[model samples]
Target: MRSARRQYLLESALMTNPLHTFQAWLDDAKRHGVHEPTAMALGTVDEHNHPSVRMVLLKHADEQGFVFYTNTESPKAMDLDHCPFASLCFYWNPPGRQVRVNGRVELVSIEEADAYFNSRPYLSRIGARASRQSQPLDGYAELERAVASEMLRYPRGHVPRPKNWTGYRVIPQMIELWKERPFRLHERLQYTRTGNHWTEQELFP
Candidate 1:
């Protein structure tokens, strides 16, 4: 019964602009206190064409692209440098919805990254400085020491965004939205981007 009602609502939304429907769904998730509402699994390929995936927080999204922040020198960023193609998968289990995006990734303008960085909490800015993501940690004590050192350096005043940390925007070529339904059925809507327009189609599941 619940799944049926959700399916009905989702189908109605998808009948309209699927992008609008997705933003509405994401807004609902944010309002309903879904932790990490914009968190998505990012998939990318390295130089040798090996696939890798990791959870990344979505910082921005619009008709233009989907954006996330990361250290520019990180392994993922290095992979993105080599191969700009990537994918994002967002699953909201409580809402029984999933959104998939496949696209070419690009670094957002430095100004844009700076503005977003300025908006982040001071501690987060400091934390960004302390973390060397994906690097093998010597120990918890070592991490704490780094944090303490950074905190002392910043001293509750303004924290500058690290030069290495910035944002990447994924310009989608394909976007797919799915909603679970009863009796093993599901509603799937896909949008394929071509030039300035997007073509929408429904898929059987």
Candidate 2:
């Protein structure tokens, strides 16, 4: 039974585009009760080539690639401005599956950012306006005061999207998927994009 299951998974991995396959796995993770199923570790490099990584939520994903939103003035955003290349990694322990994506990053359109910003919860929008992301704050009280100030400014109506808050899309050049197995012998599949098509291959465990 274990052999049959492994074979099935391998076949499935080769049968679809990596983005679609990743979405399927993400859905399974959600169904299996994995917390923060959309969370991914984002890796980026600064102008000096220093690498930094942090966990970010995967807000969108499709044929174009993965998308996430953040403050344009944040450290990660600064790194992206200097070096647009990035990598994203998703691991779902409950399903023993992982996905890795490497690509170039680009800012989403202003219209896209506006739409998403409007959809955010009211308090979240206010918080985005209040925080000066990646900048050193005097203290917790300072942050609280900023939030309070933003609340007063917005009052009861729509909170406009901050100019520095926006979204980015990672246009993937390569994607890799891995499934765990006994004794550390794992199944690995990789897809590399060329022009409009993707070439798929299996890697040694």
Candidate 3:
């Protein structure tokens, strides 16, 4: 029964335009009440080839790729500087669906970063200015003092985007979609990019 379900999913899967297909699945996940549907696990490697993974919100996704923002001094940013490759995974348990992406990371344009930063809430803008991300914090009081100081400096609508806070875009080279079945049987479909087009193939689960 489970194997039949898996086979049906494989036969019905979309095999072109992985980006559009991903967006459709994401929309379904959202409609299914998946918590934090845009949240994904990002994996990066350091200069020593040691891997690190963390959860980050997906800011944007389209034909170009996925985008996420962070402080330039953060550990993830440092890892990106040393190595430009990254992998992202999105799982929606309610729908028994997962998407995996492997890509090259690049910094977004200054204009793009500034626009997104300005769209953020005023307090978030101030917090971005106050916090030195990935740095060791002295204490809770110290952070409070910093936030207070920033609040006084920026007032209400005058907070500007921090120089070191920016966005990164992951330009995907490969994308894989997985669907879980009733039993252990699963369906896996992979799409690999070649120049301007993508080639799709099924993989053994």
Candidate 4:
């Protein structure tokens, strides 16, 4: 009965815009108490053509692209630099819904990156410059010392975004939404980009 109602609502209330629908689903997930709703699995290919996946926090999403920040020198960032194509998968437990995006990656602008970086907490800003992501460290104490050292360089309210830290935008070519139903049946809606517009396809679960 719950599945039937959900299916009914999905069909009746489906938005024409995939990005809008994605934002709506995210809002719904937050209302449903899904922790860290913005967390997503980012998939990329390294220079050697090996596939890699990591969890990244989604900063923003719009018709333009889905955005996330990271150290530009990290392994994942290096992978993206070698190959611009990538994918993002987002799953919400309560609603049992998943969103998958496949597209080419591009770097966000310096001004834009600076604005978002400035919005983060001071400690987080310090951490970005303190630690070398994916690099070896002596120990937790070493990391703590590095953080402390970084903190002193830029007092409380004024930490500049590190040069190695910036944002990336995934220019989605295809977006798919999966809605789970009882008995293992699911509904999938896919949107493919066609120039400036989108073409929709319904897939069998």
Candidate 5:
């Protein structure tokens, strides 16, 4: 492909507000009932330099970055504690679009977590308290019993948020948006944050 042609395609994407463009796609995905459209693969590294990735729901996203809830005592949390950098990739296969973000990890404000927790179902809140995430479980019956016990303990269904379960926000430094095209070519646009400004660039596929 001619460099000029490629650059034109890239310019088309860049000239349009990247944030708004991508957000529009996300909203469309949600409206189309894309299964778990907010879910992304979260990647983190441990102290020993081993990398781990898992599908986590993207609970929040904006100029500040992305946020997701998890057990603070889980393996992922341990890894985050040691290495506060992470990456997130969202793939909307049906729409043939993808977004990748690299960012530093930070614990979301208590207020945010509390509000989200309160929005959860009563039974879900109880289950969050009963399950010690990432920990070995004896059996399904044991888990059910634990949940039942916790439910009884909070008969009013006003379960408090678990101290060990909270939210983490990723402060993005770089974000990439990819779109599928014909002839084995793909469109890639990236936005990088440096200090107070954002820089946009195009990558060849």
Candidate 6:
């Protein structure tokens, strides 16, 4: 039934705007009570050309592009430093929609970072500061100590965003959306940005 409805939407109107369609899919995911609807797979390549991928939450999305926060000291950070390009994939089960985005990454504004950091849970804020992120630690005790130290340093309701804790925006050059269909057949649609305009194409699946 879900696939049938989606197939009708795909065949009839198709999406005119990928961003709008992406947002619609996201809304559908939330409505279906899907867990971690914001989660996306972030793909990056280091200077050595080795590829790495990890899951990251989608913090914000707009005409500017997709935004996600991270610790700048992590391996993914180094990869982005060497190569600014990134690919992102988001999948939702009940809605059975997936979105792929390829883009160049840029640091988000300090103001945006500060606001988002402040909005995080108190413990999450402390955890962001406590973890060295990709650095070797002595043991689990060391991690606990670090967390305790951070709590004492910030106290409750006073955790501040670290300088290394920042956000990045992926300015998309291409966006492809996939909708699951009956059997093994699937539906794929792509949008390529040309100047300020976008060109859309349906793909074979």
lDDT of 6 by residue, 1-205 (tens): 2245445646554566788888888998999989999999999999999999999999999999999999998999999999999999999999888999999999999999999999999999999999989899999999999999999898887787998999999999999989898895888878999877888777787
Give candidate 6 regions above 4 Å deviation.
Answer: 1-14
Question: What local lDDT score does residue 101 receive in model 2, on the 0 to 100 scale?
Answer: 97
lDDT of 3 by residue, 1-205 (tens): 2355444664565336889879988998999999999999999999999999999999999888999999999999999999999999999988889999999999999999999999999989989999998788999898899999999998897678888899999999999989887677788888899887998777777
* Higher-lDDT candidate of 4 and 5: 4
Clashing pairs in 4: none
- Candidate 4 residues lying further than 4 Å off, grouped into runs, are 1-9
Over the stretch 46-112, how does candidate 2's per-residue lDDT look in tens digits?
9889999999999999988799999999999999999999999999998899999999999999999
Model 3: weakest 10-residue lDDT segment is 1-10
Q: What does candidate 4's lDDT look like per residue over 41-105, in tens digits?
A: 99999989999999999998998899999999999999999999999999998989999999999
- The candidate, 3 or 5, that scores higher on TM-score is 3
Per-residue CA lDDT of model 1 for 1-205, tens digit only, reads: 2345445647555344556777988987787778899999999899999999999999889887999999888899999999999999998866788999999998899899889988998888888999998799998998889889999999986788888999999998898988777886988878898886878776887
Superposed by TM-score, candidate 2 places the C-alpha of residue 137 at a distance from the truth, in angstroms, of 1.4
Candidate 2, residue 105: Cα displacement in angstroms equals: 0.5
